[model samples]
Target: MITLSGNTIYLRALEPEDLDFIYTIENNESVWEVSNTQTPYSRFLIRQYLKNAHQDIYEAKQLRLAICQQETGETIGLIDIFDFDPKNNRAGVGLVIGSQSHRNKGIGSEALALVIQYSFQQLQLHQLYANIGSDNEISLQLFTKFGFQKIGIKKDWNRVNNVYKDELLYQLIQ
Candidate 1:
């Protein structure tokens, strides 16, 4: 099993025990805009998803990892590689720190660094990209800090609250 350790945080594989934590994050309406989540997720659906979490990334075409605090072993966030295209050697990345209390801490940054290293070094991926809403300045900054460059933008890409917002495309070529 892969365990990415940082000074203050670590990334680990998702487990059945993460059901409740994932449920809370998935159903949180406040964070839906960034995730493009329009409907609430039921516990039953999440439970089924958890059962399939063991599938290898190459077979599943996606991977979601739990972000944990180093000393206390508390799961504070999730980092995902979605829309993985092994043939193309690329994938889309997404991340979320479940609560506002975890925001602005170095946890997210460290988790992202570990994921990038794994994607490029272990997975032998050529590049990683992120689709970020224009209003998500924090995420944009976090990704950009890791050398992800703005590649393009989709105008009116996501609709939130009654208005459409632009989505920025960022890419990091390894």
Candidate 2:
């Protein structure tokens, strides 16, 4: 099983049934800045994505997992290991809790913990990285809590609404 579970949340591979949840999140204009998404994704495209979700991390060079609540079994967010480099033993991590109501509830924290362990112990990865907007205090706090240090800042990296914002690169090494 690829599922990683914690007390509050679990991370599992994307499922065909998650089309609606993933669709809504991918098309949310408000979160485009965080996700670096510039356009909406059609259901047809998303369905195609789900069909390919079974590809292993090595084969796909990326993995997207659904974050679900342990109690309710409700899928609430998504987490990813991207830019996987088996030769270098590293990958990039990104996650989004689809709803504001679910933020700050420790769900992301638990989910991140699972990923860190899975990456380091299971995957034997040397490091993981995350790029975060400088203005995102919640994400800054969340990533820092896990000992991800701010390695550098990319000035004017992302342009949102005609304003260029700085993006911070954070890294964690096992």
TM-score for each candidate, following the candidate numbering: 0.97, 0.98
Alpha carbon deviation, residue 40, candidate 2 (Å):
0.2
Which pairs, if any, clash in model 2? none
RMSD of each: 1.0, 1.1
Output the lDDT of residue 147, model 1. Answer: 99
- lDDT of candidate 1 over 1-174, digit per residue (tens): 344788888888899999999999999999899788989999999999999999999999999999999899999999999999999999999999999999898888999999999899888999999999988999899999999999999999898878999999999999
Which residue runs of candidate 2 sit more than 4 Å off their true CA positions? 1-3
Q: Any idea what lDDT model 1 has?
A: 0.93
List the candidate 1 regions with Cα displacement exceeding 4 Å: 1-3
TM-score for predicted model 2 compared with the true structure: 0.98
CA lDDT of every candidate: 0.93, 0.94
Model 1 vs truth, CA RMSD = 1.0
Q: Model 2 over residues 1-174: C-alpha lDDT tens digits?
A: 543988888888888999999999999998899899999999999999999999999999999999999899899999999999999999999999999999889988998999999999889999999999999998999999999999999999999999999999999998
